[model samples]
Target: MKNNNSNIKLFIDGFKKFQKKHDNILEDTAYTQQPKAMMITCCDSRIDPSLITDTKPGELFVIRNVANLVPPFEGDLRHHGTSAAIEYGVLYLGVTDIIVLGHSNCGGIASLFSNQNKIKSSDFINNWIDIARDAKDRTLDRCKHNSQAEQINCCEKESLLISLQNLQTFPWIKDKIDKKEIYIHAWYLDLASGTIEAYNSDLKEFIPL
Candidate 1:
């Protein structure tokens, strides 16, 4: 493994290059962040929402969490990081579109198959991942004959649907969607193929985007 000094140097070098190339872009949007879309995606090291979408900084309001899962809206005072980000994006930032982006080979999603007792030691992961328990159950039931990789892929896509549904559970989000002021979407990123697919509500399937 590389030394921490080298990793820090790599970032410093990369930032120098980025500053030369995008310094003006950053300065233009420094004071005001008026992003048009909000994307809820996995906190996976392999995926960068901005790079994948060819979007620049300030163009996207991104919320990254394990398995890209979104829990149903809860009216409480608890510290809901994901929910708080969504609320800020929609109500404060006025983002017009919300996207739930899921990717292949997600370890977080794969944890759904692990023995619950094994992860009981985890302080928060076990509970956070349970948000997509229904998706895992559906994948197991529908793809029982498939291989483990295939089942994980199925769950990966299905988990996005659950997140999308959870987004609507927020009363403000649902109201905006009903009034046609905001739109919601689900997208899948196939890491192996380097391709993206969007969920078609009318067709009830994912198609190349």
Candidate 2:
């Protein structure tokens, strides 16, 4: 683990350097418009959506969340950052593509498979993670005899499929999909191999992206 004091100092120094570099980009982005393709990815530090896609700053509207799970449309009091971002990207920004990106060795997916009691009394996190609970259950039921790593891999792929299904629950998304104005895609990044696989709807399987 990083020593707290050193980490703090490093963060401050990094921020100082980031300010210098970010200012230039910010100025250019202010005058330029955003891209029409958006990517929803995991919050895992190892998985970078831009790096994986080799996209520039304005090339993709990216949303990062735990497990990259998209919950079904709920008009409740939840923040729904991912959903909101999707809505804005489609409705306001007129983005034509939405990519739900998942990855290997996901901690959130691992937590769903393990006992929930291990986590502290954090209802928000537990509730938020419930979005991927169905994926975990399905993985367990289908891969009952598989190894832990195999189960995790199943969940990772299943989570993307689940999110794709959830995307249809949004009325605007469904409308765009039906009119062929927008396309939804699911992708998986293998951290170890630095390879990405995209879901092939026709083949009903994941192939190299």
Candidate 3:
């Protein structure tokens, strides 16, 4: 415990405890090769999809990224991890519901308002975050008079809507949606209050769920 090597040993010991639990999870998941639902959620350490949903292993096919932004369908790109995961979940795994889950105090959404290109130091992050730039633009355009906090809140919610729209850009997804084979959902998690809200397309608002 006195040196860096000691710290590494302590970390490994903790990991061993986690591994024991993971082994049981693996056994439970072995029989369920395909998940029934898919979720796209933020890459925040505080937000654990399974824990939040009270789901066990193999219950959800999850794709996580900064701000949970889903890019529009584009064939020009050779590799798209989010889209690839979605395609596999929908087409291969036959997932019926896809949820885009956004959370409060997202660094990626906050960086959208920063003067400097915050992610420039990390090229991949900068480029990936550009996918949700439209949401940021919409927020700025409509909330010019609102407080900074309100604007950020609007952007966070709008980003979920943007991802829902982006989901439609995939022809397969669109077809599944049209056929009622798949359903899309948007959600926002307010960390301060521990309340989760689901978007009501019919009501055109977010409602507590």
Candidate 4:
């Protein structure tokens, strides 16, 4: 909040540059959007899903949150940000493909893996993170002998699968999938190595891209 604090100004400056770069597409996105897909990814500063996917403003509808998480639809009236976006994409936008993207060194997953005590004070953060506890538990149960880093990596990948599974709990999405109208995908981004892997159900593993 000091005069010397420049991140806000830096973002403003970056927006000006971005405006100059993409002013041409502004009109197209302003009137309507026909994005090819929808993506749920982390809120990490380093993970720019659009840039990574080489997509412009209207190409992909995106929902970002801590750890890129999605909770199963409970048929309640609460405002679930991730679920709302998913509904809008599938029901309104008619997005054929939905992707749940996870990244390495994810602070959210890492926090679930390591910092449970620290987040207990914030009710929402604590409860939201509890969604991925199963992923952590599964990874630990299966990889008892692996090192912490390897276990964390396993947890990260598994959590993406968990979200993919959770997507099926939404009736609309499930119906679309059952009728072959839509598809769900899982992607893992290894920021340290700058590579991506896509989940293959047949292979039961992520294949490098």
Best by TM-score: 4
lDDT of 4 by residue, 96-155 (tens): 999999999887787776643455467577688778899999999999899888888999
Clashing pairs in 3: none
Point out where model 2 deviates above 4 Å: 1-8, 15-23, 115-120
Rank order by lDDT, top first?
Answer: 1, 3, 4, 2
Report the Cα lDDT for candidate 4: 0.89
Per residue, candidate 1 scores C-alpha lDDT tens digits across 1-209 of: 76756668878999889788864777778899999899999999998999988998899999999989999999999999999999999999999999999999888988887642345458899889999899989999999999888898999999999999999999999999999999999999999899999999999999999
TM-scores, all candidates, are: 0.92, 0.88, 0.89, 0.93
RMSD of each: 2.6, 3.1, 2.6, 1.9
CA shift at 127, candidate 4, in angstroms? 1.0
Q: Residue 161 deviation, candidate 2, in Å?
A: 0.5
lDDT, candidates in the order shown: 0.91, 0.86, 0.89, 0.89
Per-residue lDDT, model 3, residue 64, is: 96
Query: TM-score ranking from best to worst?
Result: 4, 1, 3, 2
Instruction: Please tell me which predicted candidate would have the highest lDDT against the true structure.
Output: 1
Worst 10 residues of 1 by lDDT: 112-121
Task: Please identify model 4 stretches exceeding 4 Å from their true place.
Answer: 115-120
Per-residue CA lDDT of model 2 for 70-164, tens digit only, reads 98998888687888888888898888999999999888887776653355557677787889888888899999999988998999999899999
Pitting candidate 1 against candidate 4, the one with the higher TM-score is 4
Clashes of 1: 0
